[model samples]
Every structure is written in C-alpha cells, then in structure tokens.
Target: MNITYDWNKGVWSNLPLGVKVSKLHKFNALPVQFSGSYEYNFANAAVVPEWSVNLTVKLLFPM
Candidate 1:
C-alpha cells in the first residue's frame, strides 16, 4: 500500500487544477488506486471537486 501528498506552490497555483493526492493498494497482486483532487478556474472564479478509482493488473513470468 502507498499514499502520497503533492503540493505545488508556483505554476499549478495559477491553473485550473489544485492539489493532487492519491492512494494506491495492492490486492492479490493487482493494483487499485483511489484519487481525489480539487479544481480551480481562477479566471472564472470556480471551484470543483473530483474523485476517481482505478484498478490495474500486471503479468509476470519467471525467467
């Protein structure tokens, strides 16, 4: 399992995106992740919240 925190105090602050944070876990060797973030449109003065879930599988073979 893994978790992360990201903060951008310069470039990203002026864009339509905000802080990006996510968490990842391994289930039976498959990777599953959940992410949530905030969006900001400075020009329009709007804020939006978003979240997502993703699952990934990996194939491995012995050499």
Candidate 2:
C-alpha cells in the first residue's frame, strides 16, 4: 500500500504528504525471505524527514 501527495506552488501550509507501507515474508522450509517498509511525512520543511523505516532480508539462491 502506498499513498503520496506533494505540492510546491506557493504557501498552503507547506503542503506535502506521504505515506507508504509494505510487507513480505515467506518461510516454508527456511529459504529466508523478509521485507518491511514504513514511511510517513507531513512537510513543514527544514530538510524533509518526519519518519522513515525499512528492513529487508532475503537469501534464496537456486539456479
């Protein structure tokens, strides 16, 4: 799931909004797979960062 909104024309309370979510996991015999993401921002601007998180681990090699 993801949603984002951004504006840069003039002052409208510094309109910038963003949201993101992600998840993935697989384990049936331990091939290893995991994923995660989270992000949120509501800009008031000073260098743009409200909240952010991400994690991922995947190890599956079969050829």
Candidate 3:
C-alpha cells in the first residue's frame, strides 16, 4: 500500500494538486503483479472533482 499528497499551492498560485493512493498485489510465483491507483485534483473549484483510477499488470522474466 502506498499513499501520496502533493501541495503545490505554495509554489504555484493555481496549483493545488491533492492526493493519490495506490496498491499492489502479486498473482503468482511467475512474477506477475496487479497494481492500481487513484488520483484527485483540487485546483479547480468551478468543476466537479471526481476520483480517477488506473490499473496495470506487470510480468517479469527471470533467467
């Protein structure tokens, strides 16, 4: 499990990026992994904020 928070308001007046969370899981001994993450942006107030999710699969080969 991993979590991150980014506060760029101090550096940039219009920057207010919020948070991101991610998780990883192993499927098998074959070196396969599943990972997902969620991100949010807080800079825009006029627009509705929605959570975005991303997923990816990883495979590794060992010699």
Candidate 4:
C-alpha cells in the first residue's frame, strides 16, 4: 500500500492531491511474479488524468 500528496501553487485550490495503491504477487513453485498499481488524482487540471492504472510481470532466473 502507498499514498502520495503534492502541493502546487499553479493548480486549482493550491493542492494537487493524489493517491496510489499497489500490489505484488509471487509464486513459490514458479519463478514468475506479477504486480499491479492504480492511481487517482484529485486535482482540477487541464493536462492531468483523473485515474490511471499499471501492470507489470517479472521473471526471475536462477544463477
């Protein structure tokens, strides 16, 4: 879990609050892992999105 906040004077209300949540999963039988995240912005801006999401996969090789 994660949380973020930002203050911008140029933006509306002088605040550009944001929140993010993420998760990670790992398998014991396999060398594969997965992770995902979601973010939301609570600022009235022209170039910012209200919500966003991301996903990632990783493979671990044994040496």
Clash statistics: count for each candidate: 0, 0, 0, 0
Q: What is candidate 4's CA lDDT for residue 23? A: 47
Candidate 4 deviant stretches above 4 angstroms: 1-9, 12-30
Tens digits of per-residue lDDT for model 1 on 1-63? 222222543232233445656676676766666666555444322222233233444343325
For candidate 4, the lDDT comes to: 0.54
Q: Write the per-residue lDDT of candidate 3 for residues 1-63, one digit (tens) a residue.
A: 223333654332222334444444455656666666655644443443444567777786658
Q: Write model 4 residue lDDT over 1-63, tens digit each, in one string.
A: 233334454444223344444444457755776766765655544455666676777787767
Clashing pairs in 4: none
Q: Candidate 1 regions off by >4 Å?
A: 1-14, 45-63
Off by over 4 Å in 2: 1-28, 43-48, 51-53, 58-63
Which candidate has the highest lDDT of all?
Answer: 4
Best by TM-score: 4
Residue 7 lDDT in model 3? Answer: 60
Clash total of candidate 1: 0
Write down the lDDT of every candidate, Cα atoms only: 0.43, 0.52, 0.49, 0.54
Model 2 poorest ten-residue lDDT run: 11-20
Q: Is candidate 2 or candidate 4 better by TM-score?
A: 4
Clashing pairs in 2: none
Error of 1 at 48 (Å): 9.8
